[model samples]
Structure formats: structure tokens, C-alpha cells
Target: MPMAAEEIEAMIRAAIPDAHVEITDLAGDGDHYAARVVSESFRGLPRPQQHRRVYDALGGRMGGVLHALQLTTATPDRGV
Candidate 1:
């Protein structure tokens, strides 16, 4: 099954309370998505680590509920 944008956003928010997340269904299918996230928690994290953190929030749902995710994580105006 595919995941909902709200669910994805909620997962991210749960992980990073201060994060601003925008989830989109890129393929018009719930499984494929793109998320642009801005968070204070990403302040000192690297790009790869930032992505991993978002994935971690999904809790292994990557290949199951979520098929593909194009993620962009940053900290306010600064890129993570």
C-alpha cells in the first residue's frame, strides 16, 4: 500500500518537532513522493545524514508503504 502525504508529514513532525515539511505525490500515486523539509534539528547534520533521519522517521516503510522518496532537507535558509 502507498502512504499518504499527511502521514509522511506527521512522521517527520514526530521526529523533528520544529520541522517544516511539504510532502507531494510526485507520480500521483501515494507510493512515490517528494518531501521538502526545513528543520532546526538539521542544523549540524550532513546532507546524507539528513536524508537518513527522514527515512528513519518512516520506520522501515520505505520499500513497503513508500516506494520512492526524493527528499530535500535543510535548516531554514541554510541547506543541510
Candidate 2:
């Protein structure tokens, strides 16, 4: 079964309480998604690390229920 966009957003928000998360379903399929995550906690982190934080929020669901995620991460001032 594919994951719901709301479920993905909730998971990220749970991990990063202060984050602003936007999830989009690409190709009209729940398996393919694009997520924009902005958080103050990502201020000094590198791009890879920031992406990792969001991935970690998914709890290892990346290759299972969630197929593909095009992720964009940024800080408040950085903008999406």
C-alpha cells in the first residue's frame, strides 16, 4: 500500500516540532511525493544532513510504503 501525504507530513512534524512541511503527490500516485521542509533546526546543517533529517522522519519507510520522495529542505530565512 502507498503512504498518504498527510501521514508523511505528520511524521516529519512529529520529529521536527518547529518545522513547516509541505507534501505534494507527484504523478497522482501516493508512492511518488515531493516534500518541502523548512525548519529552524536546519539552519547550520549541510544539504545532505538536512535531507537525512526528513528521511529519518519517515522511519525507514522510504523503500517500502513510500517509493520516491523529491525533497527540498531549507531554513526559515532560506526559503523553499
Candidate 3:
């Protein structure tokens, strides 16, 4: 069974409380999703590490219930 968008979002939100996330359904199949996450926590993490943080948020569901995730992560800009 594919994961629900809400479930996916909730998992990530729980892990990164200060994140700003946008979830999009790529194929309407529930298995493929595109997520853009902006967080202050990403300030120093490298690309691979940033993605790894999100993958970790999924709690090892990447290859099982969640098939594919196209992600774009960055640090949110504060008023400057």
C-alpha cells in the first residue's frame, strides 16, 4: 500500500518542527511524491545529508510503502 500524503507530511513535520514543507503528488499514485522542504535546520547540512535527513524522517519506508520522492531542500530566508 502506498503512503498517504498527510502521513508523509506528518512524519516529516514531526521530525523537523521548524520546517516549511510543500508536498506534491507527481503521478496521483501515492507512491511518487515531490517534496520541497525549507528549514533553518538545513543551514549547514550538505545535499546528501539534507536528503538523508528527510529519508530518515520516513523511518525506513523509502523502498517499501513509499516508492519515490523527489526532494528540494533549502534554508528558509529570514527577513534580512
The prediction achieving the highest TM-score against the true structure is 2
List, residue by residue over 1-80, the lDDT tens digit for candidate 1.
77889999999999988888988899998988999999988888899999999999999999887899999999997742
Alpha-carbon local distance difference test for all models: 0.89, 0.95, 0.90
lDDT of 2 by residue, 42-78 (tens): 9999999999999999999999999999999999998
* Per-residue accuracy of model 3 over 3-67 as CA lDDT, tens digit each: 99999999999999988888998999999999998889988889899889999999999989999
The positional error of residue 11 in candidate 3, measured at the CA in angstroms, is 0.3
- Runs in model 3 deviating more than 4 A are 78-80
lDDT-superior candidate, 1 or 2: 2
lDDT of model 3 at position 21: 80
For model 1, the stretches where C-alpha displacement exceeds 4 angstroms are none
TM-score of 2: 0.97
